[model samples]
Target chain A: MAKEKSSTKPESPAESSGHGGGGKSGGEVNVFDHLELLSAMGRDFASSLDIEASLKRAIEHITNYVNAEGGALFMLDDEGETLRCHASVGPVEIIGLTLEADQGIVGRCVQSNASEFIRDVSKDKAFHGGVDEETGFTTRSILCAPMSVKDERIGAIELINKRGGDGLFADSDLHLLEAMSASAAMAIINARMAEALVEQERLARELELAAEIQRSLLPEPGGEDYPVVGVNHPARTVSGDFYDFFPLDDGRICFNLGDVSGKGMNAALLMAKTASLYRCLGKTVRTPGRLMARVNTEICETATRGMFVTLAGGIYDPKTGIIRLANAGHEPPLFHRPDGEFQDFPAEAPPVGITPILADGDEFPEIELHLDGGTLYIFTDGVTEGYLEDGSELEVEGFKTLIRDNAAQDTATRLDAVISLIKRGDTALRDDLTLLAIDDAKGHAARQAGESPEPVSVDIEAAAVEEELLLSLTVPSRADRLKTIRNAVTEAAKLCGLGKDPAHDVVLAVDEACQNIIRHAYGGSPNGKIKLKICRTEGELIILLRDFAETIDVSKVKPRELDDVKPGGLGTHFIREVMDETYFLDPPVDGGNLLRMIKRL
Target chain B: MNHEIKEDGGAVIVALEGDVDLQSSPDARKVLLECVGRKMPVLVDLSGVGYIDSSGVASLVESLQSARKTGSNLILVAVSEGARRVLELARLDKVFTICDTVEDGIAQVRP
Candidate 1:
């Protein structure tokens, strides 16, 4: 291939009319005739916004116009530091090749930003023989031009081995190739610009979607009966603490405020899962204690144990003026009374999903508050535990005072005052602060004034539906029969809801209730058969379960206190939360345990 | 919106049955592009349409791009009350010549 270089260098201009611009001296064309042809070529090349196709077409033009054997175009790498081959017309194998500065004729054009006409390759010290060796073709005379836009040299184009010719590549050939390279350079620049614009647009779309997912995870502000005020201020685009609320049957509203262990996407995901789990159980579970127990067991089974969630949930019964609440290892909730005094509800048990199970005889404290004309404030640690300018944590007591002082005003004013107090001596909230305030005064007033409105009944029974597995049983009306059925339903539902076991948690809760009634209430009494009714909703499973046991205990049962740590006698605790409703009704002839269990589907 | 067109040996027709405002313009555009890109002379039926907006006009223009690409034609039929007001507001009533009835629109597209 190197020996053919000497044969292509044409020694005389007289025999090379077709090789250069000298053939255009006939004077039949206009002054800008060459410019017009070049402009037309530029327009044709630049019209296409496609990078790969534009480069390929430019390479073809370089080979045909310059009368060379083949040509290759090399561009700067993404970082714009190294020259990588972009297009080649003649040699298929050498297309998309790479060359470094100071390497070959292509490198010299890129480094010097000048055109080079080499008539003989073996005599030129800068010539590299790799292309010749790969193509097995003669590298005779060569015309190389710098591919630059303005003063910036992006790459170089090299036309190798002039076809049907001998002698050095003329000056006019260099001029024509140089003009072609200018347009090629502009095409390369335009393509790169378009690619960058496309990349930026894609990133913006992804960010918008991420923002949407984050917004969807948050609970809606306020509710139908409960005028709730929810505020979540994330330190970044997303935060770890999440709060959610969903309606419950029998005029109860189930809501939870939770704090995940960390922040960012992982914590956001965990927050979503935790909120969903709490919402699911809140719909199924009847009371706070039972809800915490079911949630604790499920979280322990599925969630990372070390990374637990501190959640406080309550079912507000506007009809009875009673709020049944159970807390799992979270900040103590603050209650601001009409008398301008602050009382903190204690979170007597560890956070749910961390412990394996509620121990027998362990007291699960359930707080039954008769909400009067006052406000209930639920917040994350970000509000009180935040550092002040003096580097002091506000603590629970300080937050309580703040709420008590501000509760007399409108809800918005009260919230603003509370936040202002927290940020009094600080510039910004150091962590994400979440505050939820619900006004109970209006409902309380309506009830106290002897104008009783109908309770906001969200019937979960309407949504109870089951598809995968069904458990149906009819046992005799014996005291033991009720206990056995309760135990079976509760166990089934819990295992089913827990991700790993795949057994339904609602079914298991029902089973536990049956077993408790059988062992304690009937005590081997002679009675007819009992019935357990289980159904599923679109998002929950409802158990219209009933059992006949004459001695079913209704009143003297001690509700599980949160401080007790034993496990065996938690049947009542589980029943209260796992089943949406549990009522001991008197039979048409005799009293019996009439329990209803609802589990999220 | 109603569309009818006759080009070469084929015909195309489009029919709309609801408000063709900004809210429903995306659906209108998708359906119109389908008719034009198929190289069928087109007819658009706007007998039941209650409204149209500038967004609807833009979608119709997009159909023109596809019609030109496939070498077909598009014609509108039975302009409604609210739709005609929008087309008049945009001065597009002059741009797109209208046919009074579905039969007239179809005849305009017949070879």
Candidate 2:
């Protein structure tokens, strides 16, 4: 574009000057003098869009054509707020200084929206002195005009030290500068617009990639028997908070919701990694508590030194009607009871991946709820710390009130109302918000209320016999070993003539037992020893695995969901699922941990 | 399982040509998902397959698990001695309908 204009400019100006006819200027007395000169000046000014080259050409053309000694062109900055020296030629020493609309002779032209002609710089109060000192020259005259665009004064173009042999800058010099200023202003505006378009294209491409990654990381809505809903709304193109849910075996639903500390692409990228790690490890490990533990370790290993994630994850047992949940310094979960009571469980701890040695006994938090018909609502700080109109943060008390006010609405409507309130009350949410709600009403329907069954004693002898036959004698505790144990036990139950259903039970049971040893006893160190003994007893095949390690406090432990995707402990639920009877014991006085598994044969 | 998928006409011939063990099961599952994703009938030939573990069998079972919904069929063909020994040892021979050759596996496809 610049090339076409530059080429056209020279031809038009020569034609107007009648230079192509090779006629010399006829002694200042022509039939059409000002008309020819004005046409030639317009051609010279309209030639190029390259601000640098056009400014250079304009200054030279003004000096030679109008017979001016020096000139300067100041173009407006992109914001239209400041004027900067863009180009200059001859003896105008001050080339790069900025001039505000009320600062100097040039500024006065922009402010008054008119041109100025000064015969002597010493007579003007606005003549900034630094230029004369550096150039070792005295400014004799100044011709200044506003580079106005659509009646808006963008900047001022000034010509100095005119040379018409003895007179100061006349009306013709000002007229010539005004014409050049108009075209130069147009060129500057066009160049800035083009630059903005290029930058926007680059940003659009980056956003596309981020959206693609975010979509791929989200879990599908339906797969297992239970129904689930997951939503993410980033304040920008991407969010630093994420939520994911997938199915697990034994009619369990695994899910996690997390938030990274910062915002933008960096926070979004970290959120993606955190979500992926939970999904991968959830599929590999069955329990939520263990999943979070491992996810914490992995994040600590790869994340920025101080980076951490506030996460909450658990598995919902659709059959058992229980939710095994764990938290990593995240918001306390809000519970809405079917009877209209609301409670927010505050079993919070430090955020995951923040510390290597979390308080061993006290820091490990496990909270279980017999979520008969209650709703578990989890969210990021963007929800709780949402800004109120007065700039104060919305605390948990306000959120509880919101839930209480909207308790009668359906689950979908309730969630929508909550989001609306947050948006209305807090126009400026300082962080990203993520919310997840799950209800186990159907699971509650499967059971009769108030049915009390006496707890039966576990037949240890029978479980030990079952474990002996099914389990691989003593294998190192790796995920691979878990696979080996799952397969071997499944096959043994089938061989024992327990049929397909019972075989699945035995497989799930043995997996839990082996995992307990692997997680709590061995700690995935691959150096610990675990023994398996499988046998048959009284219409059931019994299995017992023992590890000569620190005794596990069976009473202090809560049953965890086997398929909880994000990390935490899920050992006890796997036990409940696979075995008709589960028993935990410690050797009389020694440090040996025993887990017995039994399935009716 | 080391999956080597080759297209033959409209069908895909996925050659399981190595030991299908615990470590290789995930890769096998991914290949099966890809085949189903493309809506192709897959004849998984186990003739060159040397060994099969429970995890490998689980992958094949998962293929059967999701194939119907994905509108695809997965069949096993040409089980070698080593692989057959392992599958029979794990009692999965009764679970999967096996064929003696790749042609028979393709013939066993219902639709």
What are the root-mean-square deviations of the candidates from the true structure over C-alphas? Answer: 24.6, 15.6
* Candidate 1 Cα RMSD after full superposition onto the native fold (Å): 24.6
lDDT of 1 by residue, A181-215 (tens): 88888877887788889998987777557657867
Taking all chains together, the TM-score of candidate 2 against the true structure is 0.53
Restricted to chain B, the TM-score per model reads 0.84, 0.82
**Tens digit per residue, CA lDDT, model 2, A1-601:** 2224335556444345532121123434321333454445455545544557766666666555555677887766656556678778776545677766466787677778788888888898988666778778778788888877787667877888866456476565566567767766666666666778889999988888887788778776553434455556667678889999887643468888998988888888889899999988887565666678778888888888667788998887665567888888888887778777777776456787787565654234667877777778888888888777677777777777777787676555666776776576435556666788786655566554533232222333433443344444677766566666666776777768876655654665576567566655654456877767677656768777877667654432432322221112333544564467776543434466776566775
Cα lDDT, all candidates = 0.64, 0.67
Q: What class would a CAPRI assessor give candidate 2's docking?
A: incorrect
Please compute DockQ, using alpha carbons, for every candidate against the native two-chain complex.
0.01, 0.03
- The local lDDT score (0 to 100) that residue A122 gets in candidate 1 is 90
- TM-score of model 1's chain A: 0.59
Output the TM-score of candidate 1.
0.52
Error of 1 at A296 (Å): 6.6
**TM-score versus the correct structure, for each prediction:** 0.52, 0.53
